[model samples]
Target: MEATPGASVATAIRLISRDKAAAASSTCGPGLASPPWAFDGAALPQYGPGASAADPAPAATPRQGALPSEYLEASDEELEARISAAKSGLGDRVVILGHFYQRDEVVRHADFVGDSFQLAQAAASRPEAEAIVFCGVHFMAETADLLSGPEQAVLLPNLAAGCSMADMADIDSVEECWEQLEAVFRGRETAGAAPVIPVTYMNSSAALKAFCGRHGGIVCTSSNAAAVLAWAFERGQRVLFFPDQHLGRNTAKAMGIPLEAMPMWNPRLPLGGNTEEQLRHSRVLLWNGFCSVHKRFTTDQITAARQQFPGVRVIVHPECPMPVVDAADESGSTDYIRKAIEAAEPGSTFAVGTEINMVRRLAAAHPEHTIFCLDPVICPCSTMYRIHPGYLAWVLEGLVRGEQHNRITVPDDVAAPARTALERMLAVRP
Candidate 1:
């Protein structure tokens, strides 16, 4: 994965960033009407760091086209019947991949259910399927599109199902941040220090993944972030992490990297709002992005859970803020949290800090163990919740009719490099 020093890296960054920024900000976005799989955060729920749901529900999709009235008005039984019929008709041609955060109604229909990376791997494993119905957020669908065969179409049930945290670090902003870093570390590699390596989380857009690939960088998921960082350090003097500050901080901190060695990069400000000296001395440059659902978890909830369920083992996602992660008994990815609960003693109690849907489902599945979400408020991923069962029925029915609706396709130019980055990730033995 080591990239030689060259001008193409800088040139590619500038060109790709401009093109992606223009496309991303283009109008007539996704949803009921608009173009298929277009990203318009306006229609998405507000649930990022420092964001509150009290704000009016942003337009959930383009106003130009509305979901067909038939889908919305269909009775639950009718919708289920239609979904079952569509699946039967399509037979093995289609594969439904669901994220753990999906509602029970939609999840029950998925042929395979798992986390983001797991779902992507599942899609890759099923080369026989001509279509992949990804029941997850926009970036996840994009990942599936990149990983699956070119002939295989990837459909996102709800085009408006976009992640707010992923939107925070657009290709343009990341490129600008990189330019600032280059200015700070001028000729450092020539002076014996290796150049900084760009590391994006799996939750980012395909364009971001391509950016990493083009720049000789690699992508990391929650489960393998520590290993990815270790890989980065061996080849580079520093790492630039994005779209989730909490995960970057927590992972680096766990690796014994001091807090002062990790500086947050604010794209809105000049020089990422950090001094030249700070950027030089930093081991990890964290982007000012965070998950809304994970941020809702607090240390107080941990205390309350402990007080109520005495000896309850508290586990949380690394996406949570540092104090919350520090207070928890263990912090890992969603799959890690699930495995811990499944492996615990039958009568053991647990308090989990993650998306509410997954937590509630776990509680329901393992009645012998007392499991509850740390956040008393039902704060599911508002964006993930956009994948209603109604949308699933509509898309499946479309497939039955030989109509391609909301298919997520990454352009070949972008997919090539993005796939390289992902392949490098898979090669890492973490």
Candidate 2:
């Protein structure tokens, strides 16, 4: 990772600050001057640095307490040594799951590496382990907790690491919106007609998944959103999708649903900012939320890439806005992009629209082809960047000392139903 916004990137910023010109040229900068452990001390919580730096963290989002001084003060070399020692001591007792968006420094230490959907499935693979250390974000760890055995602990190195898209839809706001939807859809379920079905993206909180389960809804990942949408359409006349409106809208539109039939739900508005007639005519209600990261991609960027690299293949994540997806040569999940590159001809040039670290890694992995990110400015999922090597070392050392820190556990009430919705997604054949 040349200049990732992750721990190494943060460290580079800190180390180079003394050299004004060098620091100015570095990727780590004004957005991430401080390390992951040190917050800007703002009134509301923040996503440290990267794409979602400007988004306000929800009030209920987990706030990580300061890491011990030693972890912060230690050199990167020292932290790496400590993490390695702890892993050696724990052996098979602890398994670390890393998401594709994580930095190379952290990914090297992970036993399993994949996208969020793949990581969810991997969580259950090591049932014999005592702990599942998730090196992703808050929602991911919660999902791991819901899937892993009851006795197995799921720990997140940085509690503040959360998805901006996931935080956009809180349980309270969703509940309020659902009540209005019920009123709007009243009498629509008679004569064996299915009612509106809620479909939550896997990027949401476990509480939301539980909400779906209790309300006759289901969970979906970017890889399986289309399948889940199909499942919802089979049984329900209408669907309410949340978190990332781009993913919902993109997936639904791909299935030939007209833009006019899909409406946006503004939590602050009555009837989700829709007219009563529009609500009745709606086939899918997309929440007024989006991923700050993917939201940066534009049709302009695709056009620019095409002009710059004549035959460059443009592949983007579905989390991106519909226009960006439609403008590209192909659109799919993170896994899809990775696989497409892997299976491409040796001389292909790819302009990828996703996290920077992953794009850089893919480029490095297959040097025969030229690969680059659509956003030349290199913005990562700032929250994912929060899981610096220091945090991993701190948690790992605690585990070696027979202590657990930052363990994520969904309440029984939430877990039971959340599990059901997740199971429903699993039951669907992609």
Candidate 3:
């Protein structure tokens, strides 16, 4: 059974299993335990030591069976009831943090709904809560674990909910890039200026953040990227921004840095495929990475939105490509997008270039404003959408039964330095 386009790996597996079971029942033969589509190709890289983003291990069969059958077969009402009961039972012991990109099903159950940085701060504020259930991606769970108290357990409902862009810049690849940059700028540092200061986005792995902290670097979110870049320049001659080239380029460009000064670093290429002159003249060394969801927004979509709705204010996330950002009327973080719509006059039109779930929610929330996604094609953050209602029910039920499932714990060495970087970012004012 071929997977459908835009369908998640888990959804595809479930569909295949349902079809096979139905066919077997009619044929009067035993159903296959696993789907025929399961094949070993490459295993997903784990977030730990010696994990390589470039070289993938052999893939194992899909793990849809790992989810409890009861949860999968349960009706919406049943699942909702179970989740509500579990939340009520846990009460102050647990805090659920959901990102803006999460589906409405999961978002409705969250104690706090905000962007990644806001969610992390929310987790930190709730020290009394013993468990922090992060209804976001793997990196977010790790961040919550880092920010929350040591006694607090951070749980991610689905372990497969990983960020593709975050995986693009592994620790090893980034360290290699740093080594090459050091060689390039060996004798360039003078009395007042250092070579380059590293800055990792909040979407990156904990190891990358630790790398930044150890090297006198800081972590940045979309909300404070410009200010963070300004801080970096105060101490270093140049900045090595990573894991999302689009964000780095867009932020630097907004700061009046020339396009020629922001050179992209492709991990596959030697010295990031740039000449020595280009490296020396570069102000922001952007890693060649991007959000798969945001990258789907094209300038054509923006044009169509404007054509359809006259006076539509186009807003986009910085993770979008430079062309899309340039085409949009305004661009900022998810929180900024929400606030912009809130501040708009009644009956204002907004064409948002971000995840579809958030756009739809915003549209529903503010009926007065004509809010719509730039891309007509449905495109959600696939990894984030992996956290289905069934998974949420399963995890919540487990917690009710005194069991901790899918708890995300960062190593002490990694967490310590990562926390330092996070602290620096928290201290920075926009």
* Most lDDT-accurate candidate: 2
**Candidate 1 local lDDT, residue 173:** 93
TM-score of each: 0.87, 0.95, 0.87
Give Cα-based local distance difference scores for all models.
0.80, 0.87, 0.81
Global Cα RMSD, each model:
12.3, 2.5, 6.9
Clashing pairs in 3: 41-59, 42-58, 42-59, 43-57, 43-58, 43-59
- Model 2 lDDT on a 0 to 1 scale: 0.87
lDDT digits (tens) for residues 320-407 of candidate 3: 9999999999899999999999999998999999887788788878888888888764445656766777888888888888899888
How accurate locally is residue 327 in candidate 3, as Cα lDDT from 0 to 100? 91
Q: Which lDDT tens digits does candidate 1 get at residues 4-114?
A: 222121122233334544323321111212122232334554432112233233333222135687977886689888889999999999999999987666887999989
Query: Model 3, stretches more than 4 Å misplaced?
Result: 1-65
Instruction: Give lDDT: candidate 2, residue 332.
Output: 87
Better of 2 and 3 by lDDT: 2
CA shift at 236, candidate 1, in angstroms?
0.6
Between prediction 1 and prediction 2, which has the larger TM-score? Answer: 2
